[model samples]
Target chain A: EDQVTQSPEALRLQEGESSSLNCSYTVSGLRGLFWYRQDPGKGPEFLFTLYSAGEEKEKERLKATLTKKESFLHITAPKPEDSATYLCAVQPPGGTSGSRLTFGEGTQLTVNP
Target chain B: AAGVIQSPRHLIKEKRETATLKCYPIPRHDTVYWYQQGPGQDPQFLISFYEKMQSDKGSIPDRFSAQQFSDYHSELNMSSLELGDSALYFCASSLPNQPQHFGDGTRLSIL
Candidate 1:
């Protein structure tokens, strides 16, 4: 069975603190790994998409790196406005439902001012 | 840039009632996907359509049905509503093999 797991269900950090969130997955064949930031009561906003191991993507203070079995989202000097539930999802290669994604429970990050 | 659009941002229905949710994909996007997110849970894939055809299905219940139209808009028809069906329904759109763009979603509540 394909599954995505995220660790550190909740994290509280002071402004400008740095931390990393973990996402581990077990899939038949990896196609793409996606990261999204969702604010309360709103739709998820796209962040980054990692397609292969050893690949990394960055935007502003957020960086995402992927490996064979897991991925990491590293935040640097995070601000209070950057706080949101970070979601990790994985898409498997062509199958009955090729485009369907399996998502992790998400990491709730709270950056205090 | 245009984004996916969903109608009836909120809906309240009683048990055994039926409800319909609509989705309008971004212009020129040919694929549409539907997902259901329960309280405090990750979004779960329900179904998808490509070029007005049912391309794939996930854990959607038998009481629910969905279809895409000629203009690429889609609708989800759910019958026999239950409390468990109260959730946030998200509609996403993308070109084949591209990253999907999601709508704000409709919050459904059952009383």
Candidate 2:
């Protein structure tokens, strides 16, 4: 079965605190890794796409890095508004180049002022 | 421009009834997909429509069916709805296998 396990299911941090979330997966064939931010009562918003090992993508205080077996979402000096569920998903074999994403359960981050 | 549009933002139905959810893909996209997300769970794929045909079907039961039109719009129909059918159904669109842009989703409550 294709599976994605995310670590530290939930995280709470003071404003400006930095942390990292992990996503490890088992897929039939790996094509790409993606990160999304979903606020309560809203659809997930795309954040980044990593196409290969050693590749990294960044936006604002969030940065995503990929490896052969895992990916990391690193938040630097996060603000309260950044508090939301961060989801990591992988596109496996069977679908086209960028097909349906197999998502993880997501990590909920609460940033406090 | 709209990324994706799904109608009936919220629906309440009784068990054994039928419900049809509609989706209009982005004008530039050619693929439409459906997914169900239950509370506290990740989204699960239900089905997908591409080129007026079914391209992918997930582990959902037989009660669920889908249709696509020439314009690339799609509909997901659930017959004999059950209590477990309550969920947020999201419609998304994209190029063949590209990253999908999603709609706000429909919240269904099967009583």
Candidate 3:
């Protein structure tokens, strides 16, 4: 079975503080890795998709990097609005269960202003 | 720029009752996926459809069934609803090999 595990289940940071969240995974064959941010009572918003090792994508204050076994979401200078649950999901090569995302437990990040 | 849309943002049902959740995918997207999230839990995949055809299955219960229509809209029919069925149900849409965009989700509560 495809599995994803995120580290540091909960994190608290001061405004403008920088940190990184880790997501480790094991899959039969990786098709894609996705990053999402979800607020309380809201659906996940798309962040990034990493398809291969050594690949990286960046948004305003977020940068996502991928490797063979894990992915990292680095926050450059977070604000209170940046606080949310970060989720990592993996997609396997197309099959009966492929195209369906298997998500990690997620990391709850809280940034204090 | 349109995102996926889910109807009946919130629902209330009783045990043994039946409920239907609807999803309208974004334009030009031919794939749709359903996921259920319990309190304090990550979203779990339920099912998916591509071009109006069943494409993938996950941990969905036997009482739940879903289908995509010719217009790319989808519905999830859940029967014999139980308290355990109460959760946030999300619908996502995407093109092949692209990132899936999610709807705000339908909050289902069973009493």
Q: What DockQ results do all the predictions give, each relative to the true complex?
A: 0.56, 0.54, 0.60
Chain A TM per candidate, in order of listing: 0.96, 0.94, 0.96
All candidates: TM-score: 0.97, 0.96, 0.98
Per-residue lDDT of B61 in model 1: 99
Q: Please state the Cα-based DockQ of model 1 relative to the true two-chain complex.
A: 0.56
Candidate 2, CAPRI quality class derived from DockQ = medium
lDDT of 3 at A35: 99
lDDT of 3 by residue, B2-104 (tens): 9899989999999999999999999999999999999999999999998888899999999999999989999999999999999999999998878889999
How far in Å is the alpha carbon of B107 misplaced in model 1? 0.3
lDDT of 1 by residue, A1-113 (tens): 68999988999999999999999999999889999999999988889999999999999999999999999999999999999999999988774332887889999999999
Candidate 2 residue pairs in clash (backbone atoms < 3 Å): A98-B97
Q: Give me the candidate number with maximum DockQ.
A: 3
Error of 1 at A82 (Å): 0.6
lDDT of 2 at B16: 99
Q: What C-alpha root-mean-square deviation, in Å, does candidate 3 show against the real structure?
A: 1.3
Sort the candidates on lDDT, descending order: 3, 1, 2
Assess candidate 1 and give its TM-score to the true structure: 0.97
